[model samples]
Target: MSAEPLVADHAHEVSDHGHDPHATTTGLSHIKLAMWVFLGSECLLFGGLISTYLLYKTRGNGRTLPTDVFDIPFTSVSSFVLLMSSLTMVLALSAVSRGEAEAGRTWLLATALLGGVFVGGQVYEFTAFVREGVAFTTNPASSAFFTLTGFHGVHVSLGIVMLMSLFVASVKGKLTQRNAETVEIVGLYWHFVDIVWIFIFTVIYLIPAD
Candidate 1:
């Protein structure tokens, strides 16, 4: 009945029942789970955009259709550049996983540069379209096309920003193997963006317009 004995008994009971609060029951990090959910939502968004583009692609009246204006060879080159960025992204993640911060930063910068190149090509294409009177208001097809592709460009630009931020973090000694999951998450996003472009290129560019 002594106070010291009661306190010691409570301490033992608590120690026996305690668990690690930071441990995940599913064996997956919360950040990764959240990223998967976000990617799922993005899939729905891109799906709707692609469907809209397909639905309205034939609605242009006396306006420039995709067949008339699409520069397939140029776009193919840009697509290849973006595709290569995915490779660099994987390399970045691998370097980070191995605690090679300098190499990871280099690969991240490479990926960002490739993404920038792709965006530059998109800008050029958009400029040429406007110059040729294929403005967003030209027709339904033009509107849908611009919206779909523009959204994708925005995603790529955001991805580039993230890559550059990661590079800076690596340079500052903030990124390491301990937090390599961050790089993996960003790589997931970058790969998703590239895959979406593949679909867009095939459905909007490679396929013939009716």
Candidate 2:
């Protein structure tokens, strides 16, 4: 009986039906861990930036302040567009989860396009400000405003690159059963960018500066 059981175990191992109990972790699990660590560090970075912006928001010197220069209605629309892009990003992840690669790619492209539009709007707004005499070095208010919002734009641009890459990979069949987690990771990053914009919009546009 002992010999029979041993033979059965050996047969199972030889069959390809058994998994490796001691296999090393790879793929999505590793990606999630790295993202968690990166996000934690980013929290500190954004927190310090927010604190500095608030501290120097209104220096004693006359400055091109947010209150004076911000176009509330236009920025409000841009902010809404960014927030909606987060929804599209989630839908992209959902499409991947459902194994609908084409749908996922479509949604990813949409999200990236929306991000591009948002960034373009930001560029236009900045250019308008410059045209209206609000250079970054012209005042502490302008400096803080541009630094905080400009950093957020940089993040959005990075997210766009990641989204476009994912879309291309999906088209090429590189993203498959082995890589849906890549989509989830990108979704997390895209969502973070959207949430950060929410805070930036509130601080830079809605809040009353002292």
Candidate 3:
């Protein structure tokens, strides 16, 4: 019944309902839940693409298949760069939550730059594959391969855009501690993209081609 306890309760209540514009009755942010649902749907989509690729991977019309043209070492480096971006994303969220605006923006920019590098690497890899006689229209296998990886690259590109948006917001002094949840939401998307790439890399690159 102390004034201090009452003040603490009021602060907590304000923190919940005041900061989040998308709060639900269950105290969860509806926006966050929606993001989770979206990601779940994306999983099914990627699953279908991966399954199709697997089915047609070796059916290359006796031409160059994905495995024949993969530059594993180069892709491995790109994958590492993308995974490192996830770490930078974590740092961004941490900095924003602590109200370190400058550090948060720095991390956000770093994450976006890393994503750009990954996407660039993917483009280079695709061009290299085409040079090696494996192209999107070269065979069913190539078509599926390009479709799957291309979708992922697009997702990464979108995530980079989101990160850069946050950076711009920070620069304009619009992003702050209250925007921490927004950063976390973007992090969810970026991490999801990165995780999907891991699966794609393991399936298409690491797995031995018989």
Which one is best on lDDT? Answer: 3
Q: Report the C-alpha lDDT of model 1 over 1-210, residue by residue, as the tens digit.
A: 213312222222233334433344564566778899999999999999999989989888887865578899999999999999999999999999999888899999999999999999999999998888788999998999999999999999999999999988898899989778889999999999999999998989998886
Candidate 1 TM-score over all chains jointly:
0.89
Work out the TM-score per prediction: 0.89, 0.85, 0.89
> What residue runs in model 3 are displaced by over 4 Å at the alpha carbon?
1-23
Report the number of clashing residue pairs per model.
0, 0, 0
lDDT of model 1 at position 42: 95
lDDT of 3 by residue, 117-201 (tens): 9999999999999988999999999999999999999999999999999999999999989879889999999999999988998
Q: Candidate 1 vs. truth: CA RMSD? A: 7.1
Model 3 alpha-carbon miss at residue 127, Å: 0.7
**Deviation from native of the Cα of residue 48 in model 3, angstroms:** 0.5
lDDT of 2 by residue, 45-77 (tens): 888788778887776267566557778898998
- Clash pairs, model 3 backbone: none
- Window of ten residues with lowest summed lDDT in model 2: 1-10
lDDT values for all models: 0.88, 0.80, 0.89
